[model samples]
Target: MPAGSSTGSLLQTLFALILVLAVLGALAWFLKRYGPKVGGGNANVRVVGSLNLGGRERIVVVEVGNEWIVVGASPGRINALATMPRQDAQHGDHGGTNAALAPHSPAAHSFADWLKQTIDKRK
Candidate 1:
């Protein structure tokens, strides 16, 4: 057995294992901390009502009053939108002031969208 090759292979395998574990750990933590709530159970978000913004534009009523919002899952995509008439108003989000709010990575998509995009890009 070649000592150098065996040592290098062992190190590579260990690195790969560590990477996988780290990814899984992060995902689990995210799910536990920020996963949306459902029914009467605990969740990061709560659905209080439902409204059809338009045909096939059904939005689950989430936040309202201060800043009416319609959050829902569409085509496996989780979306949170402000349901106010004046979109550029001051009290939009109603969560808090975010003068620095901007689109992050063009708004993350669902796993299905990611998969579709990856395949489309390859073609």
Candidate 2:
């Protein structure tokens, strides 16, 4: 093989590698800028709260429509533990203060605490 031919082949290989990387970078940028949203921007379903139970288990409170759904999630399974009517913002207030905003209020308990109490009540 001629010396000039070998140099030309090396340059061609480098150029091809650079071109492939440029295309991949552009594709990534396009996807990140105009990709579909994770939840599809749904307004009806919202996560009210969540509590970690163990290494891969969690209790999640999801607000769907006009109700709150308590769910237990672990790896591949999600179970509906309970359901309750959604508490409106107006009903969350006591006197002139919101119970959730009051640190010392009984209703200010964390989601985990509330779930514990609810489970205890059922027994």
Candidate 3:
């Protein structure tokens, strides 16, 4: 093999590698700037709270429109447990706590405690 040919081949390989890396970097930047949102872009539906019941079971509170729906989710099944009016967000009652479902006091037990008590009564 000619020395000149080997150097040309090495340069070609490096150029290909650099091109691939540049393409990958551009794709990552585009995705970071324009990818789908974490939860979703829908304004009508939002997850207000969630409590893990077991390894695969959880109770989720979802706010839809003017009401909040309690849902029980486990593996392949999801069931709506209850529905109630949406809580007021103006009083800092957003993101994972509902005053109607649990007491509203700094000294009070956490929402998980209230949920556990409610579940114990059903058994």
Candidate 4:
């Protein structure tokens, strides 16, 4: 092949590579800004609420059960500030320490009130 033809071909290939990279980068950005919207499916996950950005609102979902519980507002309305780890759920967890769902249930805010009781009990 002629030297000029080879050089032209090389430049064309370079241009094609650059274009492909740019397109890939844009796609990654779009997904990074909007990927978790579709990631919430587990029943243990909790949803606080949703938010509308531009014209689309993403459903927010949090995972909480078994060993971990996430607390976050749905639809990307809130960012996580603090998270607390709790005991792993026993087979009878709902009727154990925090039995809010039982017929002979304990107080609703038993867990929340524990903190207050802790300090008082210490005194």
lDDT of candidates 1 onward, in order: 0.52, 0.72, 0.75, 0.48
Clash pairs detected, candidate 3:
none
Best by lDDT: 3
Which wins on TM-score, candidate 1 or candidate 2?
Answer: 2
Per-residue accuracy of model 3 over 1-112 as CA lDDT, tens digit each: 6999999999999999999999999999999899966767789998888989899999998989988787999999999976666766535767455354433323214456
Give the clashing residue pairs of candidate 2, or none: none
How far is 49's C-alpha from truth in model 1 (Å)? 30
Model 1: ten consecutive residues of lowest lDDT: 94-103
Which residue pairs in model 1 clash with each other?
Answer: 37-43
Ranking by TM-score: 2, 3, 4, 1
| Window of ten residues with lowest summed lDDT in model 4 | 99-108
Show where candidate 2 strays beyond 4 Å.
35-40, 90-123
Model 3 RMSD in Å is 6.4
Model 1 agreement with the true structure over 67-112: per-residue lDDT tens digits:
4354655666767643432122245543222222223323223323
TM-scores vs. true structure, each candidate: 0.31, 0.63, 0.55, 0.34
